[model samples]
Target chain A: MSTSRSSASSKSGARQSKVTVNSQWKAYLQHHRVTAKDSLIRLLKSPGSSIMTWLVLGIALSLPMTLFVSLENVKQLSRVWDQSSQISVYLKKGVVPRLAQGLSDEIQALPQVTSAYYISPELALKEFSAATGLSDVVEGLESNPLPGVISVVPSLASQDAKAMEKLQDQLMHFVQVESVQLDLLWVKRLYQFMELGQRMVWALALLLGLAVLLIIGNTIRLSIENRRDEILVVKLVGGTDAFVRRPFLYTGIWFGLGGGLIAWFLLSLGLYWLSGPVEQLIGLYGSEFVLSGLGVKDSLLLICDGVVLGWLGAWLAVSRHLARINP
Target chain B: MAHVRFDNVSKSYPGGHHALSGVNFEINQGEIAFLTGHSGAGKSTLLKLIMLMEKATQGQVLVDGVNLSRLGNSQIPYHRRRVGVVFQNHQLLFDRSVFENVALPLRISGYSSRDLERRVRAALDKVGLLKKEKQSPIELSGGEQQRIGIARAVVNKPSLILADEPTGNLDPTLSAEIMRLFEQFNDVGVSVLIASHDLPLIDRLDHRVIGLKDGRLLNERPAGGL
Candidate 1:
């Protein structure tokens, strides 16, 4: 009977300890809830200040994000252009059409050559006349000024700039070949310009990002100053720095989140506004390419960036100013 | 043991204005004392030292047996949890309701939700402002706001309570009522230190009065009855 009684007491003690642990957890959660509620209320109290912070952050975040998206678009276009780098080798003026066709076949036989096109001097002249709308002028000439040409479209694996240049040098060494032209200068210039633009965009984004941080930091500093008396009272009433800082941190997060949402909205509006004109211009070029705005992944990244910036700005403000406001 | 003590404590501002000079005093557990002086006499500075809001430029402040000067930044919060404080202007958050304002300490100390609700209601009841729990501090009168401050201070059941001119903004009748509240808390074994310039109120309270003059201890007088 004594053994049973002891065992029963042990069980009851275990239950009591379990209850105590549960109560402690409940208390901790309650404390966090109270802090969160207070923070939200504090942010909602001053709508003017909150809106001002959100707008400043939104504008700052949008500039970098928009530039990044444009850079990505340019990169995509360049990748497509880079893949189309091919070389055209023209034969000598006196070369016969049959000889040019034989030369084209011989070039195709080379391991590096993907495909070759044989165009006779007459056909080349005809194509030129049709394209340039100067058939009479060309017809009156004693002989066709154009030469027979072999257009070589390299394999996708050998389409790099260096590989194409090397192949052009090889074609120039051909006895019957007059000249080899790749005509990729415009594409190369476009690629280089895009690289420069990417760097400029990043530099501008960084400067503007710093400006955003300062704007947020200053706003939070002002907020702390305005609530100087309240902070003093809180500290006097046994409130810790963490307790005093919780609301301000939440305010910063809200500003960041709101700014992110606003930036995303503005970007979508800009894209929508520009879509009509962009489509019209594309139609004029007889192409079906459409201007793409931020995609799902990019949009999510933009929002996260905004929130991070907001949080960082708030952290700077709170850490610096909260120390100065003693009870 | 001394519930609160200041040993040779001095505070000098950046421009070299000494707020307190070589002040030494101790308040035993459950004692009630009034810290009295004119404006700029360092009464507030003394209270601040106990709260760990400001470090003494020289010497030590021990509260509940912990030397505050030796405490690290993170340890200050735990030390503050053991004390309650009321301010002159009440400094109640205007955005919060009276109940939420009074519940600040309890929330900081991390009470259970049910316990916080019960303790907050009890504190408001004790301050005779339970009916005003739903009202905002901005809507309450100065006296009511002061009561709310008192409620907030005592809600955590701290061992020591400090008041810096808590009744400075209230009229005579309200000030007397507030003093009575402090006295009641002392009767329940909480050490109380109040800084005030109201001689008549200190005289009526019959507690020990520590007087300060020009940042120095002038006199220590025990109330006539006590």
Candidate 2:
């Protein structure tokens, strides 16, 4: 009778096990959902401290990000300046306006030149006076001292130092050209400076990323200590390491999400605050350049980085402390 | 086969304090036994070995015919699931409701929500705390809290139950009630091994007793032989 009872139950158990295979996946997802929601609620419950942690993480995340966006704007500014770096060919005193115009047309036809424009002596004098506020002093001269000038913009392919120098040497061979000047030294220096700045930004980002890890790790460690009893009880009641680790991991992820959003907010706010002043300053430079903040892709990246760092920090903290709790 | 077997098991701490030595015993399937000893007599250590909370310093521990020493780290949770444990302090999470507390093991085992709810209610109903399922364990009385712990232990329907000083903080009547609860589970073919120093209670219950003294096996008393 016992054998028959056991066999019948075993048959039913086999059927139940088959159904459990599908339900097991559902249960796993449900647990994750529950843990994630519970962790988020825990964070919401302690809004004061949660915000404090997020703020710390935000500040850490924003420091390098602020530098990065500023560097991006500086790069944009350099590109504008780079396009303006042209060969200024000053003609001899005897050269007439029509001859200067012809020379400009000839230079424009060169394969290396993108465009060339002749600046009459009068326009150059006016620009010089307007820039220096010395119009009256320039009007006192009997003859216009400024020569007819031809400004030559090299093609995109010839923007490098060697190519610009070569174009300068080529323009110097013109008979009407008195001197062909290309002040590319400062542009080259600026390029080097920007490169160095980029390296510095990367280094700063590395350091700050480490700071973020340490901050999150320390926070998680303290939380683990606070929930030590819960952990002990869970372990005592057949909770797997992964099961015990889930809620804390979710906490870390929530922290990361909040911190990322905050960092993005801080960055946008900083750019917005600086934008008006920056536009006024660029207006003084006589260029209509707009200051750009962290764009959507970069904002998403920042958040993802925050999440990854938070997870890593929590994992590190939990692993270290979990090994010590035997119960 | 025995549900729990200790073959000359011995355990020592790092400082050379032996918690158990040459302890050999068995609690057969569906048999209820009491582990009786004074404080520091390795009763807890013996339970720990069965739960894989601590490894024996020497010899073998076989539970439900599986050699525990051979089980890998990842398999420990699966092993633990087959054995339920009730702690002396009745380790309930005060942060949650009694229902959630009892649902913990089932949750850890990844039970479906419907099954979890049903089984949790069943366990709580068995413990006679079904009405207080929504209340926090912190608000419950000592006896109720202990019963909640028992509910959590039995919620997963484990083959064996081990209680460490389960009735230590209870009055005689409450303690007897708890022991009778264990008896009810044993009647349903679940093996039970409870560690306690309450000799009078153990004497009255009249179950088999495995006695330990200074980390060594002292005596084994059959039911009604005291």
Point to the candidate with the largest TM-score: 2
Best by lDDT: 2
- Residue pairs in clash, model 2: none
Q: Model 2, B83-136: lDDT tens per residue?
A: 888989998899999999999998888889888899899999998999999999
Which residue segments of model 1 deviate by more than 4 Å?
A1-59, A74-84, A89-150, A154-180, B14-16, B38-40, B169-173, B222-226
Docking class of 1: incorrect
Tens-digit per-residue lDDT, A73-152, candidate 1: 66665555555666879888898778888889988997778899998889889999999999999989998888888989
Deviation (Å) of A112 in candidate 2: 6.2
What is the TM-score (0 to 1) of candidate 1?
A: 0.80
Summarize candidate 1's per-residue lDDT along B1-226 as a digit string, tens digits: 6778888999999998999999999987777889999999999999988988789999989986788888998888778877788889777888679998987776666666677788899889999999999999999889888889889888877767899998897889999999999988776667789999998888887878999998999999975554
Each candidate's fnat, listed in order, reads: 0.30, 0.37
Q: How many backbone overlaps does candidate 1 show?
A: 0
lDDT of 2 by residue, A1-327 (tens): 122222333233233212277788899999999999999999899999999999999999888888999999998887777788888998999898888899899999999999999999999999999999998999898988888899888897788777888888898998988998888899778878888999999999999989988888888888889899999988888788999999988988888888888999999988999999999999999986899888889999999999998998889888988878877
- Evaluated on CA atoms against the true complex, candidate 1 attains a DockQ of 0.19
lDDT of 2 at B42: 97
TM-score of chain B of 2: 0.99
> What is each predicted model's overall lDDT from 0 to 1?
0.81, 0.88
